[model samples]
Target: MAGISGLKVIVKKNKMKIVVLISILVLSVSCRNKEIKSVEKIDTSKETEEIISENKSKPDTSYTTDIPHIEDFQNEVMKEEDILFNGRLKKYFTLSEFETVFGQNDSIKLLLEEEPCYTIFENKDGSVDPEDKYLYKEGSRFENSKDKVAVDEFKFTKSNFVLFKGIRLDSSTSISDLQKIFPNATKNIGSMDVYKEGKVQVIQLREDENNVSDGHINIFIKNGKLYSMHWWYPC
Candidate 1:
């Protein structure tokens, strides 16, 4: 009877050992699965960071908010009809041509001593006087070089001289009127002393981003009325 009890005890011990071994195997598998999950999580985070870095390295190509180029502004806002002066825009004219437009050569005053030498075609009419309304060939010694030149600029102090599409220096013209006429025109606010009050606006065309050329117009409005205008173009 005692021998049979010992055999039963040994069998019970063996069964407990088998259960412990199986538990250990299951725990090992669970730990390995947890390690693999941790590695996968790290890889996913790394991939996400890489994607974000790549996106940051790429250049932004959106120009929707950028100011339009000068040429584009002219084409879109101030069309050819709006800028025609005496049926022509900023064209170089020979002395004969200028004479034909203004009158005989003797009537036109050629200012040789002035810097950036220009010519004057004073209106005998009292409305727009004194300020000879045209720039001679810019950067040329007018006394020496008889080269062909044109009216590179026009200074308008009176309301009678129409600048663009019947727009002139008059009480009827206002900042709002200019804004309507040139929707894309840029303001020279807080830059030049003349524009400190945010009243002067600059209209430029044919000037590139690098400022390779000089072609622009300045309109000054005071007390909500168009005060004066200056139109300029490269020779």
Candidate 2:
């Protein structure tokens, strides 16, 4: 009976050892699987980072061809007859010539001041005179209110004028389009860039240069659209 009891104890010990061995084997396989999954996750994360880096390094080629080189505008001469003021292709006009085309019967108001040197012609209602709303320097002469008075500067608060190249100086003009039109324009003065062609100057404003006023051309722009244009003659 004693020998039989001893044999049973030995069998129990062997069964316990087998159970521990099986548990160890299962634990080893679990650890290996976890390690492989961790490696795969790290590789995936690295690949994702690499893709993002490559995308960020890529150059933006969308607007490259749209904006022409500044050199393209160098030595470019626009015809004087192409500059339009109220459909009149004349950079500067005499008061007589203006009345001749619009007829002498038109009602226009002329405000002549000598202190600051300005001669303004507006509508009878004190609004923008599309036919003739110009500001000139002092000493500008007009014989009988119908004589020639070289326009020093003009304003287009209500008139629609286009450049020789069909570039409209209205509220619909864009800064980019303006840059393309006058590639030689200066960087920016306040909210607008000034382009000069002899006695004429074209001023364009960005969204930022609209608030400050200095009596120059007040170009109004909203949401990248030119809404209004003011032309101040270059002194």
Candidate 3:
């Protein structure tokens, strides 16, 4: 009986050892599969991160999508027929020439007695109908020379005179008519004391619309008609 029991114990011990070896083998295989899956997950996460970073580095050009395009203006050079008043007088008209044509001024005053004096012409007399005035700058061309008296600006007040193309100031005349008369004229930004700068439309007349730096004329409009005008030479 003892011999038989000892044999049984040996067999039981061998069976227990086999069970432990099988469990260890199963656990090793499970750990290897888990490691491989973890490696694959890490590779996939890196690829996704690289794709996101590449997308973030690109520029977004959506700002200019909705802006409207503007067309360029076609400017036309002025012609001789565009001259104001009688279309005979030219800019910088000399004092001697003016006196010869229009006779002596009603009154003359030296507004500025300095080296480059400013002379003003007034026609208060009832002989010549229009209340015309001219401003001359002495020594405008040469220093302290009376021979170089230049007509810097002129004003025609209380007059219903017709301009180029028979354009005149009257109740029927609109701003559009003035613009048609001076198509190349631009909006004037200079001083206008008689009318509100915003309420009135003032345009600067140029010999060549392309050359803005040269001498020009400023025409003021009020109540849809011509209010005042002045020729500027920037002396």
Candidate 4:
């Protein structure tokens, strides 16, 4: 062995080596912890994105899905509505009763029995025609296309209507307007049969067998509102 001073120097060198090893170990542990944190953040971000995507893909839960198809759902709704809304006890009537429901004289003009009847539909913007606006085309029979009747009336021989409007609710309308038109009609029976004119309201009668119904009326609905009414006329 060497002198005591030599021994002290060797001890000092051994301690320095141990300190370096400890520092290297601490740095490795810190790097491992940082990598773990990065992985956790990535997983959380991916999970959040998946949740958002799932929410967007889901459809409405409130609508009925028990039916096999969309049409089945509609049929079920109509059947349910008929049961709930129909309250008429008068099933069938004689020709006199038919005349009683419909007026004795001509009230509604049957202008377009061959083609579609014309009626002016209020524009959707709910804007009434401007007072100064005149619908016309230069040297044309129709002043303007917009000036023409906006509504078309059709006579239905069947109980069901499958008509649809792409950009508009063609069958949708307010019941208030019908009420105002037909003050005599206090309630709806089997079909949509309400009409309004000054003080006299005409009833539109619809029948499954063409103007002969003692029970059931069919109402037309569109755009979440009542469009038209019809019940059978006893013939």
Candidate 5:
């Protein structure tokens, strides 16, 4: 009887030990699952932070702005036309074959009579014969000289005239145009940047029709107004 009792106690103790082992197994599985969940959360947080940091490192450079209108440019062109026709301007120019790039002003007149020369000596080369005895218009020179003006001083700097190819200009053209028109004369224009003298402007041309010129000529501006001009011809 005592042996049977002892066996029963051992069975009970074994049962208790089995129950504790199962509980420990279950607790360990739960803890491992919790650890996996924590690892996932940590990885997700690190990914989010990396994305935010990349965004912060990059800069946004978007370009969105309207261009400028050309009203002032148009007004300047009209003023140039007036000066071209007026007796005041005294610059030289030949026909401008180069068309306007902006579709602003396209048609310009090519007039030989505009020069007002009575006799033009035919030379073989592209040059003028100042002392050609065959062509003499003294009266034209005298009358144009009566309409002359002196030049006033303006602030001057280096010239950028090498950029242009011809003497003619449009409203879209700037002092840069003038600089490029005549490389040879641009150097001669010691003051350089003509526009530096805000007072000076390229208005009309004054010329001596009979004097014989090949290319452009220079005229002076004074005060606000332009007087007569002094160019051999061609401006």
Candidate 6:
């Protein structure tokens, strides 16, 4: 009977060993599956960060603020016709209008010898021909002359002239004042100034002891006062 009990006990011990071995194999498989899932999650997170970084490095081509359109520029240029002069939209005077303003003075005459054509007006009673001659187009308006449609050129030789835009000027009109009015004037010499508008020299101020005179429009000054102004057009 004792021998039979020993055999039964051995069988029970073998069954317990088999169960422990199965449990160990199942636990190892479960731990390996969890580790693989963790690794996959880390790789996905890295891929997402790389995509975000690449998108940030690219330039945005759709932004276009503060860029002026071509139509805006055209509109600005079209508005030039509304420029005011002499409290009116007329930027220049016609021959008849000039005559009306200064009257039919005997001092004015046409200069056929002058290049680009001109009309000279002087002080009738001044001695030495006044050392100045106001020049304008003979038959056309001031705007026509300026636009190169009438006379070729014009200028003022005398300084004491109240011109269009109410530009009351003389030799006494300082260089600083002229710069304020014509911010584009270039310094030619001592107190001699030259202003160019649209490739043509429109105004010049000359003050030199050397008597150097060469410009479309010339302004000669003495004693810091405007002595003369000359206007002409380039051929």
lDDT of 5 by residue, 1-235 (tens): 9999999999999999999999999999999999999999999999999999999898865554465554312211111233332122322222121111111222222223334443233345643343322111210121211122111111111210111122433223444444443333333332222433444433422222332334333433334232222333432
lDDT of 6 at 135: 36
User: Tens-digit lDDT track for model 6 on 123-196?
Assistant: 24422132233234322123222212122233323412434345555435665666555443334424444343
What TM-score does model 5 achieve against the real structure? 0.32
lDDT by residue for model 3 (185-228), tens: 54323345552245565677665645655665566666666655
RMSD of 6: 12.2
By TM-score, the better pick of 3 and 5 is: 3
lDDT of 2 by residue, 9-120 (tens): 9999999999999999999999999999999999999999999999889987776666667654342333445556546646455655656543343333343323223334
Relative to the unseen true structure, what is the C-alpha lDDT of residue 113 in candidate 2, on a scale of 0 to 100?
A: 25
lDDT of each: 0.49, 0.49, 0.50, 0.37, 0.36, 0.43
TM-score per model over all chains: 0.37, 0.34, 0.39, 0.30, 0.32, 0.35
TM-score of 4: 0.30
Query: Cα miss at 53, model 6 (Å)?
Result: 11
Query: Which segments of model 3 are wrong by more than 4 Å?
Result: 1-85, 111-150, 157-173, 183-191, 195-200, 212-215, 233-235
Worst 10 residues of 4 by lDDT: 135-144
lDDT of 4 at 69: 50
How high is the lDDT of residue 217 in model 5?
A: 38
Give the candidates in order of TM-score, highest first. 3, 1, 6, 2, 5, 4
Tens digit per residue, CA lDDT, model 1, 160-216: 234566554344667677666655553422223452345354444333344444555
Model 6 residue 76 lDDT score: 12
Clashing pairs in 1: 118-136
Model number with the top lDDT: 3
Q: In candidate 4, what are the lDDT values of residues 1-235, reduced to their tens digit?
A: 5799899999999999999999999999999999999999999999999999999899868776566653322211111122211121122223343234322422223223212222133256633343212121111111112323211222222221222211111233345544443233324423332343122222332233232334333445433344443332232
lDDT winner between candidates 3 and 5: 3
